[model samples]
Target: MAPALNVELAAEPRSAARSRRATTEWLASVCGYASSCDIGQDIVLAVNEAVSNGIEHAYADEDGVVTVCGRIEHTAPERRPDGAGPCGAFEVCIEVSDNGRWRPPAADPGHRGRGLMMAEAAVDHLALDKGESGTVVTLRRRLGCPVSAS
Candidate 1:
């Protein structure tokens, strides 16, 4: 059994912080406390990082909503389960979409450089797609939270 939670946030730059906090709250409600907190923290952090990049590079100054979706799907307990797609592995798919520029720009200058890298390291799979609407970065992860799904 998997629970699907989808959230849409404002296009403002500071919204990334709110997104992380909102995600933390959701994880707190569902994931509980203890080590799961750490796992959830990482997930939220990674998602925020990716979303921030999208806000900066993908949409630029365009006004659009950033959508982040988390889905839990039933898969073999040994595999990824808490993820977005059907691959299982306790994974998570975080998508940041904007109605602005779709193509990914070259990595930006220093300091703001590690967001994408951090996002990639936190998840198992990373996807960046551009279309007429905008660019979306989906990060997938199957790590942390050892809770059983029997």
Candidate 2:
């Protein structure tokens, strides 16, 4: 089993790069042991998008903090009485959260606002939570599978 990663950084533009580097290193270390470097790369891309969004959109102009956490889990598929195929595997789960409320971006054709969409496309599962205090984005991708599966 790989060790979990948890990091807290300032909600600034520069922190996005820092978060990406840290996440990349951590994922590489974890996936290298499992011989799943491709999955790690995909995770880094998805994480970068989410972290960048948190810094650029969630905090905007105010001071805030972003928390990033990651872990690997093994899940067993639910058994069906009808004898369906089994689907159990290891997966990497990452969560990026910012302590600021979410605001919709203005409708500007020239402006690029597809980070979340890209993240959704890159990962197997993506979830977003927006509340009075903050927003959290969760990304998950299964390991030991082809990139298309993710």
Superposed by TM-score, candidate 2 places the C-alpha of residue 135 at a distance from the truth, in angstroms, of 0.3
* Global lDDT scores for all candidate models: 0.66, 0.79
Winning candidate number (TM-score): 2
Global CA lDDT of candidate 1, please?
0.66
lDDT value, residue 148 of candidate 2: 26
Residues 38-135 of candidate 1 have per-residue lDDT tens digits of: 55767887888867866666655667787877765434545346554433245555675666675544576556477877877776778878788777
What lDDT score is found at residue 95 in candidate 2? 95
Please give the lDDT score at residue 19 for candidate 2. 83
Off by over 4 Å in 1: 34-36, 79-89, 103-108, 146-150
Best-matching candidate per lDDT = 2
- Candidate 2: residue 89 Cα off by (Å): 2.0
